[model samples]
Target chain A: MLSVTPQHFLILSFLLVGIGFLGLLIRRNVLLMLMSLELMLNGINVALLTFSRVGSNLDGGIFVFFIMTVAAAEVAVGLALLVALYKKRNSVLSDDMGLLKN
Target chain B: MNAVDLLFWLFAVLSVGGGLSMVFSRHPVSAAMFMIVSLVGVAALFVLLESFFLAILQVLVYAGAVMVLFLFIIMLLDVGPEAGKGKLSHFKTGIFGLLATVLLVGILLTLGNSYDSLALDQSIWPELSESKDGASHSLPFSTKVSSFGYGLMTKYMLPIQVSGFMLLAAMVGVIILSKKTPDREDLK
Candidate 1:
């Protein structure tokens, strides 16, 4: 309990991902869902860093850098889509955007 | 009981607690704030791992730029706490939550079972070797910014270029998505 190991970091990563997944499952607001997505990505980042440290591999760090780049791009595109959706529907709830459900 | 252990636990609690609060928070703005807290905590963990460069990048990109973008959107949309209250049935949400919980538990259990195999030999850290021309120069991995730069500019060059292109595409896409389409009257 006192000593920190790779396992502890891995567990933390899993917990973060789990919480994010729970949020994604339950949340209806698109923005909240996006936030949860970020949380999940962060969790993955933790795992990657841990592996990088344990193996002394720089590839993991490189992967993380790319992940961050991709994440930023995703958020930009996602939020823009969200704005367009709001403009059209006047609501950000996923339930309201189901125009094809009928 | 050691400083590393204490710091790990402190930041772990901070990050996990921030995540929980972000998920459960009633307001989108507050949720974003909590996410910033969580990102900062994760940055601290990066520092603990001795990846100072990545830690700073996490703070600058995630906690700084990405979060500001989130807040800007929140304000632009004028979203309120009411936006969070969905009309979805509780039964469906409950079922989904249960399924998610089950999946999480399964993954954690698998991880726990494989925990022994994941143990690291602290003494043996890989020292990457780069062979140029005839000479093979060995580079021991250290959490240094210079090393990251070297790797990015050399081995990971293609991926970085691809990432740059993707970012440009995203920028163009966002502009197009958010642009006001000229109505028939405006066209006339």
Candidate 2:
């Protein structure tokens, strides 16, 4: 087996995260922003598995499973909310969801 | 390169490319579909990393379940390609993109040369042949499954319970927040 290094995994994770950040910053559409969030979460999962493999603990992998479930639930709820917002405003721009006043 | 390394490189390329396309694509449904491809590649990469449990979870959760939700929303919203295209925000977003790219390249280089051995540590070194071969000290055939079951049920049960609550909370929150406003419906 060709050995996979933690650093290699780190590089991949960083790429995914950077792209996600870029997507979040540049995209006007809320749905696209959510897609970018998934990219960022997957990047974190990759880092977790890399640690799990290198550290010889099953805990990181287990944590990733939880993270995945959380992410799934988050997507479901976020989209439903997005759909509702679209009904009100006829748009899904990040700037338009002004429900929370600070 | 060994087979595992080769597979890793292949899937990594596929994932990264698919992910970029997903982000930049103008069509909402295509973006969601490309995201699924990116997810599948990540799952394949997980398998290469020797975490069988994680790989399966990735396939079933992110690729299968999450994508379905995303697709459902895209279809429901009718945010097709025509809906996605629009006027640009400002040139500042371009600057931010440039900054992000440079920072990412910097991180990649800082990690430096995957050729280094420090990347491999004692923990990851393949299980010592002696340990796996030691039949006397190792687990027996029938006990392996039961032992794993007990370990998960006992040692790492908290996460399982938390995930259930998280789902419930998210579902209720989404429902409450999305309810139609009486005024808006009356106006229509």
Candidate 3:
């Protein structure tokens, strides 16, 4: 019987973070980019939970709770802004977000 | 070594596969689906961690609530990865993406040793004392929702208040962002 190590969580989380960074780099769409941001947040949640187990306290779990709360609020406000931007400019891509570059 | 470890591995595999697919899948609907799997896997991991409260919250708030908003936005937009295809510079992105992968692999190997050391130093098995072993004794943590309410009102009162404030601020910001301007012709 093998116990899963904290290292497993760490490896997977960093991998997700790397992929999220790449997604943010490669994608031009604001919506996809927001989803990528959520990916990164989930990665952090994994790290926090791993540490919580390792530390013998409920702090990391609480931190993850706070992070989840923030992530929800962010997505709500963020999607609204994305919709507004699209309604104004007819695009979700980042290049079109530079409406103030005049 | 324990039931918790077994559940952890199952959910870990589910999470990684779903997360990777979420990132790479071209279709927005597919990506959203992958995310749902990943979120569920994370919730299971929380259960394995004995944070019954967080587990149910994750499922209810993230999987149930957030995913609904995601689907709504996608449908309202009426444009997914299919509609978004054939427009970006794929070749340039592919090259840069390759470079990033190489860098990421290298960095992970160097930094990952720290994690391995921590795992080696700490005991992996759960420490089940008498309180934990008593099948007849009620578990300290009740159902997810109840324990969460207890936790929030007891040990977590301050943070919960802070989160409420943050939610209020975010709502105001959303209103400001989406509100149509006063001028009738300002939309252009």
Candidate 3 structure quality by residue, lDDT tens digits, B52-118 = 7788889998899888888888888876674545456779889879987997898688776575467
Q: Between the candidate structures 1 and 3, which one is better when assessed by DockQ? A: 1
Model 2 agreement with the true structure over B1-188: per-residue lDDT tens digits: 67767887899998888889988888889988888989999998887777666777788888878888888788878876635244564577678888888988887887775447546554333452323343333321221234334435666667677778888898888877787668767664
Question: Native-contact recovery for every candidate?
Answer: 0.66, 0.64, 0.43
lDDT of 3 by residue, A1-102 (tens): 546777777776787677777778777767778888887888888788777766554556767889999999999998998888778777777877887798
The residue pairs in collision within model 2 are none
Give residue A96's lDDT in candidate 2 (0 to 100).
68
C-alpha local distance difference test of each model: 0.87, 0.76, 0.76
Interface RMSD of 3: 4.0
Q: Which stretches of candidate 1 lie over 4 Å from their true place?
A: B83-85, B120-140, B184-188
For residues B1-188, write the lDDT of model 1, one tens digit per residue: 77788999999999999999999898999999999999999999989877899999999999999999999999999888854355777899899989988988998898989877766555223344443332223233467698788888877778999999999999999998888886822542
- lDDT score for residue B38 of model 3: 86
TM agreement with the true structure for every prediction? 0.91, 0.83, 0.83
Which residue segments of model 2 deviate by more than 4 Å? A1-3, A98-102, B82-90, B113-117, B121-125, B128-151, B179-188
Candidate 1 has a TM-score of: 0.91
Clashing residue pairs for model 3: none
Against the correct fold, how does model 2 do in TM-score? 0.83
Two-way DockQ contest, 1 vs 2, winner: 1
